[model samples]
Target: MLSAVYKSLKKIDTYLFIEQRDDFSKVPEPLLAMFGTAELVTVLNLSTKDRLGIADINKVRAELAEKGFYLQIPPPPENLLKEHLAKLKEQGKLSEKYNK
Candidate 1:
């Protein structure tokens, strides 16, 4: 299936994929307001792609077929401190002072 991809100007690394080019009829008004202006990134033939860079291809196809659009948002930022603490705990290197 052919899909049009658009990048949001207000959101970093956020994209909207629609089944048809220049069609936002299925998208919600509030979502569009928050997304700001959308710039067309590219048109893709999903049938030719085995996987996408971020989104799961099967999920994307399902959403597009059911909801007429698929929204791709950036993954949450990593918490370095939490990860370090977990690693330290796993390695038995976390001191009582550090825990406090």
Candidate 2:
């Protein structure tokens, strides 16, 4: 299935995937309000049989077919936070040795 992706400016890490780019008009008003002004991310050939990077292709297709759009919210920021903490710990250790 051909899908068009939209990214929300107000909501970080949030997106909307639709079957057609022109179908944006079909999206509900309340949803558009929550999503804010969306920017086009990309148009991709998505298939259920093919593996997607972040979203399940089948689920996205089903939602797009039934509802006018599919919401694609990004995963938690835990990995970035963990990496930052690890870097901070390393810096702290280096500072302690240097100070000593």
lDDT of 1 by residue, 24-92 (tens): 999999999989999999999999999999999999999999999999999999999999998998898
lDDT of 2 by residue, 1-100 (tens): 8888889999998989988985787788999999998899998887634866688877888888798689988887678855766687777853454443
What's the TM for model 1? 0.93
Give the alpha-carbon lDDT of every model. 0.96, 0.82
Model 1 scores worst on lDDT over the 10 consecutive residues at 91-100
- Cα displacement (angstroms), candidate 2, residue 70, comes to 0.4
User: RMSD of candidate 1 to the true fold?
Assistant: 1.2
- Per-candidate alpha-carbon RMSD to the true structure: 1.2, 5.6
> What's the CA error at residue 40 for candidate 2, in Å?
0.7
